[model samples]
Target: MELVTHSPGDGVYPPTGDYAHAIEVRGAERLVFLAGTMGLDPSGVPGATLDDQLVLIWSNIRVILASAGMTVDNIVRLTSYLRDASYAGANAKARVEALGGRVVPTTAIVAQTLDSEWLIEIEVTAAS
Candidate 1:
């Protein structure tokens, strides 16, 4: 699979170590779009902080991808809904580390989420 990224002149550069872009995967036979995942752990406990939430979300994404016979590398896009956009840089860095620095899905971070108590929500699109 091929990953695609770009930096448009109108957009701010992603914080250091991250890309302000999206990834595109070509020649895939099937695609999957995951529902937005919240910060709940397997037992339904909420993560204590934004970073914790990010880790849990990425882990959940990995599980979902595996179930579909794909890996994190197959993910083409990630849209994160965050309670506060100020946390984007640190959260993005955490995500890159979680994904092993190889899968750079096109990402968008937005302020505000469906619930006030949720620090972050992540939705992904993948192919296989």
Candidate 2:
């Protein structure tokens, strides 16, 4: 599989974070669409802080992707739901770290989560 990120420099503003405006996948045989995931533990406990939650969320995503025979490098798109707009910076930081600075199409929105304890939720699409 091959992945191409598009970030037009003239017609659009540059991406503000470590993400692209769009991604194109070619010759992909498998596609995995993950559910909106929160930073809950095995016993369904949320992390106490944003940093802690970010770590758990990435770890959970890793396990889920592995189960589907994919890795973070296979991620092509991601949508993040943040309880508050202020969480955007931290969320972007965690995403860059998790993906090792690999830019992908990403969107973050300020919205309420199903659970009060969930500060952020992320759903990703991986193709391989």
Candidate 3:
């Protein structure tokens, strides 16, 4: 499980959150692209708060990765859909915690709404 991250010293500024400028995986034997995941628990109940939902969302990602015999370290990139752009701070904090500060390339877009009443949705791409 080795990934190469690039943070150029040139004009491009370094990323300030739990992400890298870019990542490259060499000799990856397998790759997985997960569906856009919502923050619903096993019981199908959404979290009561934004932070709780964010935590549960990552937990959901973990489960999906585990099913493929992979872990967070195998994740190379993620795209997030946020219902509200104002949650960026809390979202970034949650992301840092979820990845244990690992630098994964990420892109966040503010969507008008998700499939359901979800406050956030995330999709991940992993390699192994």
Q: Estimate TM-scores for all models.
A: 0.79, 0.97, 0.92
Candidate with the greatest TM-score versus the true structure: 2
- Number of clashing residue pairs, candidate 3: 0
Worst 10 residues of 2 by lDDT: 11-20
RMSD of 3: 1.4
Candidate 1 lDDT, 65-109, residue by residue in tens: 889998877777778777777977877787677667754544666
Worst 10 residues of 3 by lDDT: 112-121
Tens-digit lDDT string for candidate 3 (9-64):
78998787578999989889999999988788999888878888898899999999
How well does candidate 3 score on lDDT at residue 90?
88
- For 1-128, candidate 2 gives per-residue lDDT tens digits of 88877899998899966999999999999999999989988888999999889999999999999999899999999999999999999999999999999999999999999888999999999999
Candidate 1 TM-score to native? 0.79
1 or 2, greater by lDDT: 2
Model 1 spans > 4 angstroms off:
4-17, 20-22, 103-105
In model 3, what is the error at residue 98, expressed in angstroms?
Answer: 1.1
What's the best-to-worst order under TM-score?
2, 3, 1
